[model samples]
Target: MNRVVVLTDSRYLGQRMPGALIEALRARDMPAVSARADRLVAEVRAEEGTAPEPVWGMRRALPALRPGDLVVPRTRNAFALSLLAQAQLRGVRTVNRWEAVQAVRDKPYAVLLLARAGVPTPRTFLADRPGALAGLPGAVWPLLLKPPYGDNGHGIVRVDSPRELERLPWSEGMVLAQQYVDVAGVDVKLYGAGERVWAVRRPSPLLAPAEEWPEPVPLPVTRELRTLALACRDVFGLDLYGVDVLPSPDGPLVVDVNDFPNYTGIAEAPDVVADLVESRLTEVVHP
Candidate 1:
């Protein structure tokens, strides 16, 4: 029998997504397991007469996964990437394949991909040193400085002038400096799972007040947003993910692409993802 497994962070143990997926899969009589990404270990080995094999374990205890089993890595951490890559190497099916996940993790690379695909994205540059800021051409005053890899809006800074950029605590690695696109205090988040897309509009966290934060309201899935979301999914080779877009005077600009984001207000997201997972698994077993 084929099995469905979800690898995620321990902190998300009680979150809606993979938990909902587990329940849905079980309801369909499929064996499902939710394992913590941090607790999993991946080992790669090569033998003389055969291809390399990937071995997976939890707390040093090896778990047997069949050829047709499905492994979904919900965490974007290094360990999860390693585990997902090794599993795919061993012929297991995965959502948002490791290569795609790794590519999207780098904010600059993700933006480059979007631009190359003719998708609307913010003007971005990689700043290796503080002096690079002075050379940016056509740069609007209020710029956004973001660490290549961040979550929950952490490691992101807004600077209105060169003086503010100079005062930043210089770090070793390069940071992504992007032109801030004004959205009139609102941002749209589009969640994509398979062929389904869900959208919501909320006050931009960057501009919203701490105590008066407005709740996200469901927005109609317009053609433009749907097209952009689907294009992003195909370009990133993602099975499920979220895209953040900001409205501009000209059009919408994609600001961020996230893998397996928290489906905060999307009630049907888990079910949609579960259906896709089952469909993939069935294809693998039947083909």
Candidate 2:
């Protein structure tokens, strides 16, 4: 592939993409170009000396890609990953294939996949209706509530009991609630790239307006972390993601599986992401 076109949000078009990627492309003497959504779509001002693609919506970007080109989409939006699905339909190989990315975006669907794969995730229920909770087991006062669509722990809540459920109003889409477990302060996030797993330990970010976030436990490399990371990829079919497993008194509890986990702030830097991209590219070439 002579040209590698990376598609991502307007924010990290260049920041999160490893300088190493440019360096890696250069080492191979391949021409690589980086552009954000607006630039790629001719919406925003593209960097000087860059040619912008047609200003088409997310899905249109897929068919626009030619063979042997690389596309890295970081948006969790289904339409965003649909670009890859379009590419796949046209026989274009892309990183983190479309079907894989989409399957894990919905939390309940992801849990179902994990269950099918024999991976033990946190107890979960898919709330198909507002009153679906009436049929759910474990009618305890305190349980975890999650919206079908959530970010940064935004819609995740801990309800003390059925009393709290009464005050809440019903909405159109589905919602889910889970039995809350006693988790230690730590949340372990394992990042998988191809065959390697880079484990990072983050303290629980579950904070309220009046509370402060706690300190994180530094990551200690372990076989268990690697296994779980691989399991996440295999179960959800997502090639790139952040696997969140909370440690409980019982054992490790898999809490969240993010399609596009917060990359820039947490993953350390251009080095880590660059390494992952390069390895993926290498797999593409060698395979």
Candidate 3:
């Protein structure tokens, strides 16, 4: 029987969404299984007059998967992506294509594509070194500086002035600088699955108040926000993802895009994601 292979880390397997998704797929008789990406090994072979073959999960080998099997990428491991790339060549389908995951994994690359696609975003700049930041054109005060790649509010700094920018120990790496939008110390987290979206209001990492706001509060998904989120999906070819939007006077500005976000505040996300997976499976079976 064809199956749904959930590619994730062991840590996430015990988490809410990944754990729930496994059960949901199996409940639907989809023959779901979890493969901890970190524990899997892959072998790629190519020879004269033959297509490339990718064999995966040597450490804890997965059951042999056929072309019709579905791979749900729940982790961003590079090794996993390499394996997925080869698996795709062999006809395995991934929920969010590996290309989309790679694109959004690089913050600057994703932001550039979003802006070119005319998505509303904060003024942004990229630099190879901290010294170059002083010369960024159209830069505003209180810029949010971030490493080229990071997540969950890590490696982010608020530079309130030129002096502040110079005060920090300059690191040797690319940095993403953006116009920080202060929305009354709140951030709008837009989580999506297929065409559906849900919004939650959480404390802004860069502008949180002294008393932490209560756990992210669910918010109504507005028409404009919905359109914006979908546009991001289109830009990145993503089906399950998250968009971080800042409600500013200029309007909601997208600050970041995530691949298969935790769906932290969306209680219905697991079922919604399962529905999307089921639909994809249907397409594969019918086609």
lDDT of each: 0.78, 0.61, 0.81
lDDT of 3 by residue, 1-287 (tens): 67788888866765576888888788877789888878876665564243444355657576656678888888877887877776687677889898999999889899889989999898888888666777655448678888887776677888877776667874638888887777887889999999999999888866554235566889999999999999999999999999999999888999889889888767788889999998887683444
lDDT of 2 by residue, 156-213 (tens): 7777656567676656378777777766555777666556566666656674421254
TM-score of 3: 0.90
For candidate 1, the TM-score is 0.90
Candidate 1 runs further than 4 Å off? 47-62, 137-139, 207-215, 285-287
Clashes (N, CA, C under 3 Å) per candidate: 0, 3, 0
Model 1 residue 263 distance off true place after TM-score fit, in angstroms: 1.8
**Alpha-carbon runs more than 4 Å astray in model 3:** 47-59, 136-139, 170-172, 207-214, 284-287
TM-scores for candidates 1 onward, in order: 0.90, 0.77, 0.90
lDDT of 1 at 31: 80
On TM-score, the stronger of 1 and 2 is 1
Residue 24 lDDT (model 1): 81
In model 3, the Cα lDDT at residue 104 comes to 94
